[model samples]
Target: MATINNTPAKPEPVLSAFIKAKCPRCRRGDIFASPTYSLSGQKMHETCSHCGLHYEREPGYWYVAMFVSYAFNVAEMVTVAVGTYILTGSNSPWLYVSLLLGIIFLLSPFNYRYSRVALLYWLTPGLNFEPWRSADKPENPQQH
Candidate 1:
């Protein structure tokens, strides 16, 4: 009979996990309460449920997400500008500007959460995913 180990596997392609707000250390654990766009779903677990990884390194850490949020906002605006121009074949500056503004307002909440997730996953130094680093826990006698 074959025996199965008990250690959890490591998360991969950290970027995608970041987008989904999964734990950078172990993608198995979710960071956010909700995956979809919501007006009141910004809560995050204080520590990783799977690996005990800390979510916030220090006070004011999330403030750094402002830059990431700005970047996402700019990317969205440019996308809207190009899409509007290409589809409508119109060069009116006001049309693109108005559309960009509207989209920004609507996506602000998403941007806020996603940007923070990005900062925590990609920008935070010293923090990394070590597949071999199991959560500090007692040994299970049921496992081989």
Candidate 2:
């Protein structure tokens, strides 16, 4: 008889899981409570109601989010700089700076939300919420 390994496979990190509009916890949960957005951006819920996963670990923890934000900003600048140079056929300072700033501002909100969520998903590996399956129903539904 051959021995079989029974270890369960580890789940993938949620940060790199999906780019859709869903909470990293229970992919079905909504990150934002309302569809409205302020001058800044969409307001995200403090915690995931479905799985009770907190968005922020601590107040100061968000400071690290700036690093992620910076990386995104730099990438945007590089992309815009290269595109501007290619499109205009000249290395104009005005065009470079203007395009850089424009891309930065345009992508800021997306970067902010993604960075925060990525960090949260990375730090909380144990918060993975598996979806309920109809085929795997409880033996006694009314026991609780």
Candidate 3:
């Protein structure tokens, strides 16, 4: 019988985890408890319930998420503004501003969620579970 020792696995890259929406650890279980929003518009859970990974290391850790969120918002605004201008050739500032505000409000929650997850995925990549079966097994064990 071979004795197996458990060891923590290497962390995943931030961008990969963020894009895949996988847990920062195993990359198997989902990070969000429920992808759907509640009636009250609050997220169900901030952490990965399946793997017990904390989404926010600290309260202010998510402050950087604002940058990510802002980038998303700006990109959306640019796209909308360009599309509107091209379609209508409108020069009214109020029209563009109103349209931008409406789109931002509608997409705020999504921006918030993605920004948070991206930060977490990047900042704390190793904070995940490594199963013994996968971590302990030799890549090519020789049979005697």
Highest TM-score scorer: 1
Better of 1 and 2 by lDDT: 1
Candidate 2 structure quality by residue, lDDT tens digits, 1-144: 111373323433354344544566555455665433357457878776555557776678788878978887888888878777788887668877777788877777788777776666655556554643111221233556
The global C-alpha lDDT for each of the candidates, from Candidate 1 onward, is: 0.75, 0.62, 0.66
**Stretch of 10 with least lDDT, candidate 2:** 132-141
Tens digit per residue, CA lDDT, model 1, 33-121: 76556656667778878677788889988788898999999899888888897899998888888898899988987897888778877
Point out where model 3 deviates above 4 Å.
Answer: 1-20, 44-46, 123-144
Displacement of the residue 109 alpha carbon in candidate 2, Å: 1.5
Give the Cα error of residue 84 in candidate 3, in Å: 1.2
lDDT of 1 at 87: 94
True lDDT of residue 131, candidate 2: 42
User: Candidates' TM-scores?
Assistant: 0.77, 0.68, 0.65
lDDT by residue for model 3 (1-144), tens: 123354536545546656657666545446555453444553535665445556667778778889989999999999999999999999999999999999998888788777776766655555543542123242323443
Model 1 TM-score is 0.77
Clashing pairs in 2: none
RMSD of 3: 7.3
